[model samples]
Target: MKRYLATSAALALASGSAMASGLDRTGQPIGIIFEEGTYAEFSVATSSVDLSGNDRATTTVGSPGNPFQSATGDVGDRFNMFGAGYKRDINEQLSFAVIFDQPWGVDVNYPVGSSLLLGGTTAVADSNAITALLRYRFNENFSVHGGIRYQEIDGEINLAGGAYASIPGGTYNIRVDKDGAFGWVAGVAYEIPEIALRAALTYSSEITHNFTTFESYTAGGAATTTETKTPQSVNLDFQTGIAADTLLFANVRWAEHSVTDLIPENFGGRDLIDLDDSFTYTLGVGRKFNENWSGSLAVIYADVDGDNLVSPLAPTHGYEAIRLGVQYTQDKMKISAGIRYTRLGDAIAAPGGAVGVANFRDNDAVSFGLKVGYSF
Candidate 1:
């Protein structure tokens, strides 16, 4: 009787499989694909952040600092994606499925030297991707999977020396252009029918980004260029259903931004300014009120500390966020929407802290998404 009771409890804990769909900061989903099905999905999201007014002048420079310099601005961005997939049944005890999706990235603009340009442009780090996955089911309760990823990344860095539409001239422009690189991922999962519970563990391998940049000289002459590659990252997620109407999920991710050592290859590396590794964590609960609707709330934290800071013009430090999401499903179709409020951390003053430099602070965003899936 005691053994049977213990087994029953364990099954209960595994009934409602908890799933971690996306990261709170980058706002990327985690789940892969539906079982033995084909579907199409689309999503659109947006965000806004405001900076704090801390004197950006360095004490070492002995320069009179300008107070009340605000880095607050509008950073609205969006994403568009479309994918189709299928799941195949091998036998009663074995099955296979394939899925495709677009992963992570960011595109943002800030005031150049406290002055907003008509473009209000400063720097841009852009990224995009396409992923294909295959999964095998061992039985009614267990399975494993793996996949490949191809990605494209590029960016531009504009320093406070030249003039563009709204800001002063003399700023520096470091332009980065890249093609693509390949990566991989693998994971396992288990399901318990007795209590409607399930659990899964997934590992996403890092994909390297190789590219080139042209450095614009403030003095004169044409642009000088160089080549380099950005580092990779690892993501892990675990989810479970704790109640008939409630599910819990958590995720952890590690990113090596330090791998990015130079902008324009000809300029060489910046020893005094290099980025370090970063770790992010997320936890949330999903509640299903009825058969057709559900809602979720999650909190996230990131520790972006570095003994060596990169991009003297940008920000350094970890961030935190609170995210809320809701989903509606009706006969082969599901729609999801989410909003997040973020608090960017603080950074130490560097050589470029003078002029209108300010500590980074912005964590406001609003997002909406729609996905339609069909089972075979």
Candidate 2:
């Protein structure tokens, strides 16, 4: 039962989330520390998104009489993520682990010349992080863990459209240099191996980055510095044996994104995007058919505020998804694979918080993942 639970949780983690709330990608998991004995794993996931929308007729400037109607084309791009981790037990009560992952990202590209209002617009953000942790078991059922994380991030953005007409040539661009920062993670857990049950609660602190930024338009360009913060988050993970060879798991995650803001000095100090707090919930069950094969199914949901207005750079609002996975284990080696399909909620892209610029609906994404692990 314990092996079945771990396999299913790994599958869910590998599949990841498509267009997760508030730029979240990995959910900053720390489960490897609980693995039995010494273990190591590597995983990869890729997602293809179909997101498109149309320019709002009433919001198109200078076309008051003749409403401008044009399709925005597919703005969301395909992306890939990679992760690795190693865990080792020093004694009966002490353990450690090191993990690597791409925690947050954004990719958006509007087709050029398709939509008069938002043609040639693009935005790309990338991040990489590493965490080192130590866990100390206090008794048969209680344990505490803490860690330090180091992360790096960078991005570039290009804005074009009548909505940005204030800028020369109705185009604006910004590039941010990679920056690194440090943060911390702390958590507590309770386990009852007899019943294959465990509960964990974790907190991740926010990390701040000061990036060198360059801004440009048709006329010229200027260089300046920008400050940004990655949001703090909390996660609750629970699992237990529900039946013979069966395990049930659930997770809840919350992120405080209101404090995370991007205000480039050259852009008149106006925040590039305004994001709200976010919550995500997941539930799943895993069943072992025999000694070598086990399978799992899960559903995921992210909550959205009532407001549909959103930044054009990150257009989609909340999401609903279902994932399916299978695992095979032989001796010391294990392999897992999973797939997820996500239906994105409708949203209105309103650059600078002005609503009715564009309507994005009927968008969705599909993702696949594979992982390999070995125990010693």
Candidate 3:
């Protein structure tokens, strides 16, 4: 019950409102439009796990027909997100905006006495992001923007002896602590007056972190130690207007989740895992029914290629989503409400991956917001 509540809170923080263009605009009213604003804050969150091929009991059998049936375990949890930002108009052609939010994070735990407990994998990742941006409006028909970002990340992991009992000798353990780093980004936008079309492309740079930990490589039940570093990642976001009242947005995120293979520093060198890049796409349309009422609907697809390569550590895959929202504007104040539904696709594992890990079926979410606009 506690875990379910946590997952719900996290989803609420990260759920995006329908038809929101950018977080930096708050001027002229269009229709039932949800223009970008600090809204006093924003957030993103998810707390769930995969139990597909993680069965530990029959791991030694390793058969092609049912290699994943060994994992027989379940994972679930709860989390929350919160942040605040502000934007300013520097002039008619230039503007400035700053934002703070959590873009990447994970938290999971495998209890004692579980069959899949080999290597006792337990991990927690917490992070925060701060960004500064500058925008230039060339004319009513076009504009461009770019920025720099700073990220702070930290994590801890402990692998107990029973954790990797599936491996030959059946006894191994390790502990790790990770450090943070910095990153950057740049982007541009173009607008067409005749069709009221607007488009934007933004790129986020990579960030690296150093990790130090202890390893108990009990060959005959012995011990050891070492230090390591995990590489960062890159992300890209693109958005465009299909018509006067429709918008399309998509994002691609690539990361080196393989950094988990390096284990304790004494294992000679880093053993990089091969986690594939992920993608998410969104499409939405807004209609102005008059001056006081407006509404929108959107759909998004998320694909995280962590199937066979994934573990009890963090399970991810393809999913589909739908969203609906309505906005009311009176004078300079706007009220918005929205709802979303997400579904985790079926499982498809590769050779040598965990088995019987639970498939994250579905989730529903709703959001309410108010924005006050003033133009000088």
Candidate 4:
């Protein structure tokens, strides 16, 4: 049952992408603390996205609205994520784990020298985090875990096109130096080992970053400081054994992204990225075919609430996805592989919170993941 549960989790993690609720990538999982004995694992995932859109006739000025601009030509770029963790049991009742993961990111680039409204616009963001956690078992049925996370983030953005004509040359750029901050995590779990049932609730506090920023435009450039907060989130993970060699699992996650505002002083206090709060739900089933093989399938969904207006830097809203995974175990070594496909909701790119300037539809992405684990 435990092996099946682990396979389900790996499949779900493989499906994670930047298109998730807000800027989520890895889902900040801490399941290593629950592993039996000493365990170690490493995992990696790569995602390729196909996202493009067309400029609206309304974007062009002083002409009949007949000839609209060409397509944006796959603005979404390919990205990869890596994670590793080591867990050790201190005693019968206490355990600790150290984990590393790339938690959040974004990479977008429009073709240069194109007729599209947002041609030549680009944005790249990166983040890395390390977490140390301790878990203590109160009895066979209850346990608690808490941790501290140290994270660093950095990014740069370039805006182009007539939409940004307010700038000196219809272009603007900003680069933010990497910054580091600390946050905390806490969670509790209840389990009934006989039936393989467990429920865990986790809370992750927000981390604030203060970055030294350089802003430039056709008119001038300036060096300034900016502050931004990553969203706080809550996760509920539940699982149970449904029948012999079969398990059921589900998860619910919420992120408060409305408060994660990036308003640089040099940018006239306009929030560069505006995101709404989000909720993500997942359900899956796992089956063990034999002693050494298992497989799982899962579905993920998030609602857009009928709002399609979005930032050009991070376009798209809501999502629906399907994930499939297979695992092999022999002795103390285990290997897992999974794949996911996501359909991104349509969106209208609105710069500076204004009316729509472009439409993005029929976009999607594919992701692949592999994980290796060893227990001693």
Report the number of the highest-lDDT candidate. 2
What's the TM for model 4? Answer: 0.96
- Cα lDDT of model 3 by residue, 55-101, tens digit: 43333445435445334234333444445455666667777777676
Cα deviation of 333, candidate 3, in Å = 4.2
- Candidate 1 lDDT (Cα, whole model)? 0.48
Model 2 bad stretches (over 4 Å): 65-67
Where does candidate 3 stray beyond 4 Å? Answer: 1-73, 113-120, 160-163, 166-178, 193-195, 212-264, 267-274, 288-294, 304-307, 326-337, 347-376
Clashing pairs in 2: none
Cα TM-score per model: 0.73, 0.97, 0.67, 0.96
Candidate 4 stretches with Cα past 4 Å from truth are 59-67
Q: Locate the minimum summed-lDDT window of 10 residues in model 4.
A: 10-19
lDDT of each: 0.48, 0.87, 0.44, 0.84
Candidates ranked by lDDT: 2, 4, 1, 3
Residue by residue across 1-376, what tens digits does model 4's lDDT show? 6656666665556445536755678778887788888999999889999989887766353365656666778899999998999999999999999999988888889887653578888889999999999999999899999999999999999999766767778888999999999999999999988767889999999999999999998879999999999989898999899999888989888888787788988777788888878888889898889988888898899764438888888788888888888888899988888889989888888887677777899999899898888998
The worst-scoring run of ten residues by lDDT in candidate 2 lies at 58-67
Predicted candidate 2 versus true structure: per-residue lDDT over 99-206, tens digit per residue: 999998999998888777788889999999999999999997999999999999999999997767777778889999999999999999999887789999999999
Cα lDDT of model 1 by residue, 120-191, tens digit: 435555556656666677775787766776767666765552122122243556676766887776777776
**Each model's RMSD to truth, in Å?**
7.1, 1.3, 8.6, 1.5
**Candidate 3 residue 100 C-alpha distance from true site, Å:** 0.8
Q: Is candidate 3 or candidate 4 better by lDDT?
A: 4
